[model samples]
Target chain A: MDGNGVSGAARHAAFAPLDDGGRAEVVARRLSEAIALGLLGDGEQLPSEAELAAQLNVATVTLREALSALRSDGLVQTRRGRGGGSFARSPADASLERLRRTLRELTVHELREIGDQHRAIAGTAALLAAERAASEDLRTLDTLVDQLAGAGEPGDRRRADGRFHIELAAAGQSSRLTRQEIALQAEIGELLWMPSGEAVPHPDAVAEHREILAAVRLGDGQRARVATERHIGRGIDQLIDFHLRLARA
Target chain B: MVSDVRAEEMSAAAREVGTALDEVFAWLAELAGRFAAMHASSVAEQNQLRAADLSQLRASIFPRLTGNPRLLAGTGVIVADDVLADQPHWLEWWQHAQGGTELEFLEVDHDPASVGFYDYESAAWFVVPRDTGDRVVVGPYVDYSGTDEYMLTLAHPVSHDARFLGVAAADIRADAFEALLLRAIGAVGQPAVLANEAGRVIASNTPSKIAGSLVHEAEFAGSPVRVVLNQDAEVRDCAGLPWRIAALRG
Candidate 1:
């Protein structure tokens, strides 16, 4: 119909280009991304609405509208008067809470597929290093080698692998650099997609772990870092493939 | 001022006895006020026992004890004149704290006549208004470790509007009174004993020595004729002869 009721027209559809809600979402996401990257540290105040609007090159009203949405998301909070502005709530227990929360996301079938993915990645890494390690490298992984070789049961070897990886993180030297690596290893253990008997960490993984340690001992930061990346990356790739399989299923 | 100078020139023994008696009675009133305020006020709330009340009571009445260190210190023994509680809790509590202060609370159920016995933490027994009170003798009675301890233990009748309440007895410091007597009578370090209505030795300057004997032998050879502490009653005849019968005035 050519005729429109008074104050009832959908003006954006007729002429004014963008959806307001969409524009607000863009502002909200940018702020959230800034918070996630720690571009906004805890206790650091966000700009005033006028200042933010000027920086973002937006109308003050538009900025206010966007900030209102951000406030509702729990990503930022406000205080009053001269000293007050928005700040990030960066909890130190984020990783623990994330793992605790995301656990229910797994299904039984998805779990098994995740287990299969883990085996492929870890098994390949273990295989690759057996032929590549030097003698000293073998010696450096000796403890892990002995542990895997002597493990009384599959469950026992899985624990040995956990210890071996923790030691691997220790070899990294930087405490900050090693924390995520250790947490990821622990999270993998929690997922428990690893096979009970045959899915145990391969026998050669101990030697490879030793080889990586040896490489580091010889002042080979590059090799040590690479080996570790490969080690953790294997677990990560398994996680991705597991998710993919889960989606297909 | 000339009479005042003459008053100061009076016999040391007489002055000592006067000062001692004045201090003892003043202390009695102080103890009474404290009992009424602290001991009795506990029955209700309100620690109406402020310094002003005690200070005024000291200034207005017991002027002899106005500058007294003990009165200022707010320390001394207080025993209720009449027994109310079966077990006197305050005295028992002071015993528990191992505090040296003595407290006595009176109780009824007398053996016969107007006699009362004092029980000490030392397990010694002293009958107040000493020998005259109708009680059997127990010991070299309550041995107090306290110094210069002259005490006046007395029992006198109290009337509430012509109605007689039980006879009231008090254990008061006799050392001050005895010292005043010493000054009054010109006796230096001579012993004196004060027994109340029933003749219990409340305080003695040299009780351990003099209480046993009356210096010169008695004509009767029986027990000494007990000095009775009746209010407003005086015996001038017994003065200067190692014996005294003075009226009890509050």
Candidate 2:
């Protein structure tokens, strides 16, 4: 189908206009976060200034100010000459301050709702994967579990964790599910792992992955679904705790 | 028997669809050949295809492509590594967004480490033709990183002087392409499905099994209803592509 409802909604959300009273800081933050989350894509040329400004529903001058801010933050680069345009550059670090502000603004209800959506997508994916995954899919899941275990850095760990879930959806053999999983990871993964400065990812993450894999390998669909939901449930609890702590600060 | 006539007519309809795809492939192959020829004759240092030189050809590509009934999302050639000295990875593609008036060049993440990197070489449309030296059509799947639309990609390999160069590929909107097939098979007046070798529905006249729905493998072999190019049958293939049409009992 050309523009299935969900896909069309995703596209619309991508270029949706800013809320009233949004400024250059708001624009820069949104673009940088998207770039950091890998939505904008590294080395991808952005739309022309006027087109982008119109799409974002911002004045061209405001957009230019935002673009300069992104440039200084190393999230974007502008080149001059023929075939030259602003390009995305995936920054290595996300702004914890911005993420903290975002989390603090959201109510506990919103946080739980996001977790519910995550569990719905992931739990169904794992259940179907248990029933339908090929032997090679099992192998790939096993390998991702190993990668998560071996990952030393928090960024590496976050990436490995996100990949495992995405691959889990892919193993279910539903492209629509796989895509939803990807978008969700970009939206929520970093936030879940945001408190990475002094903390290594919980070792239990790898163990939870193993448990999910074991269930999937044994074709226990219910067990797989429950395990995935449990994993996400724990993650959301921790995020809520972090949000509360931020509010107090 | 009535069953035999039904089977023959369905087969003919399948052939008609296959032949239409074949014509598209032939046109693509010729364009690839011309691009290869142009690259070979260039006097530039190392004979690399320069952007300035290729700009001339890009201007001509969109007009010729506009003639096709299929609403092409994009079409162009991907140059193999080292073929273009100026850029390491390049796809000289032009895309017209649905309902757009003019075609615009597509720019994608070429960096290997980027999450949105478009590795065309690994994609089926490019890989199948490069490996088999034959035309290949892939998808009815989403092109998430690039177009963000569901698409079917048809590609033909481009080779020069016995060395593989790259591929000339076209991305057609799956919805439009499916519409084309639905119109072509309208005369069958039965619930017919066009499916890939994996039993994944490419398109169907029925709403029950939409694109990406899986048809049971057993249906291909065990169904009494007529199937063109049934599993392991020596029946004429769908123009050398691994697809079949089945007219199920309504």
Best by DockQ: 2
True contacts kept of 1: 0.00
lDDT of 2 at A244: 59
Clashes of each: 41, 0
- Give the poorly placed runs of model 2, Cα more than 4 Å off: A1-98, A121-150, A163-180, A195-228, B43-47, B68-70, B184-190, B221-240, B248-250
- Which is the leading candidate under lDDT? 2
Q: Candidate 1's residue-wise lDDT over B4-41, tens digit each? A: 33333333333343444334444444444443444344
Off by over 4 Å in 1: A1-249, B1-19, B38-88, B92-118, B121-180, B187-212, B216-250
List the lowest-lDDT window of 10 residues for candidate 2 chain A: A1-10
Interface RMSD of 2: 4.0
lDDT (tens digit, per residue) of candidate 2 on A1-249: 111222333333344588755588767755664453334556767779999888889999999999998898677899999999998776555575566567768778988998899999999999978876666568878988999999866556777899899888877766678889889889878776653321123578899999999999998999999999999888888667556544443
Q: Which pairs clash in model 2?
A: none
> What TM-score would chain A of each candidate receive against the reference chain A?
0.38, 0.60
